[model samples]
Target: LWSSIIKSKNKTYYLGYFWDKETAAQVVRIKRLELHGEFANHG
Candidate 1:
């Protein structure tokens, strides 16, 4: 399993665990957009 993690400011957000790396990465991207807005890095 792979863990998806995102850190913003002083808090850490856990996207979840996934069996596939692409899924994990996708989750991170989605969460980042939600949490960081225009500050999120797409790459």
Candidate 2:
């Protein structure tokens, strides 16, 4: 299995463990939105 990971401020976060890269990328997008907050980019 392959894993998706994101690191920030000396911390490591997992997006997910997936069988393929495509799924991992999708998970990363969703997780990024959650971590960054949905309204963060709203003007």
Candidate 3:
């Protein structure tokens, strides 16, 4: 299993777990965009 996490503005968000790495990364990316807005890092 793969898990994704995002830390923003001193907060840590748990984005759940997935069976694929890509899915995990995608979840983090979406969450980052939502949380960080224009400052989101897609790299």
RMSD of 3: 0.9
Please give, for residues 1-43, the per-residue lDDT of candidate 2 as tens digits. 8799976558899766999888887777776677777643312
A best-first ranking of the candidates according to their TM-score comes to 3, 1, 2
Evaluated against the true structure, the overall lDDT of model 2 is: 0.74
Candidate 3: tens digits of C-alpha lDDT, residues 1-43: 9999889879889989999999999999999889879998798
Candidate 3 total steric clashes: 0
After superposition, the stretches of candidate 2 with alpha carbons farther than 4 Å from their true spots are: 38-43
1 or 2, greater by TM-score: 1
Structure candidate 1, residue pairs in collision: none
Candidate-wise lDDT, in order: 0.92, 0.74, 0.91
Instruction: Tell me the deviation in Å of residue 2 in model 3.
Output: 0.5
TM-score of each: 0.86, 0.64, 0.87
Give candidate 1 regions above 4 Å deviation. none
Question: Residue 13 deviation, candidate 1, in Å?
Answer: 0.6
Candidate 2, run of 10 with poorest lDDT: 34-43
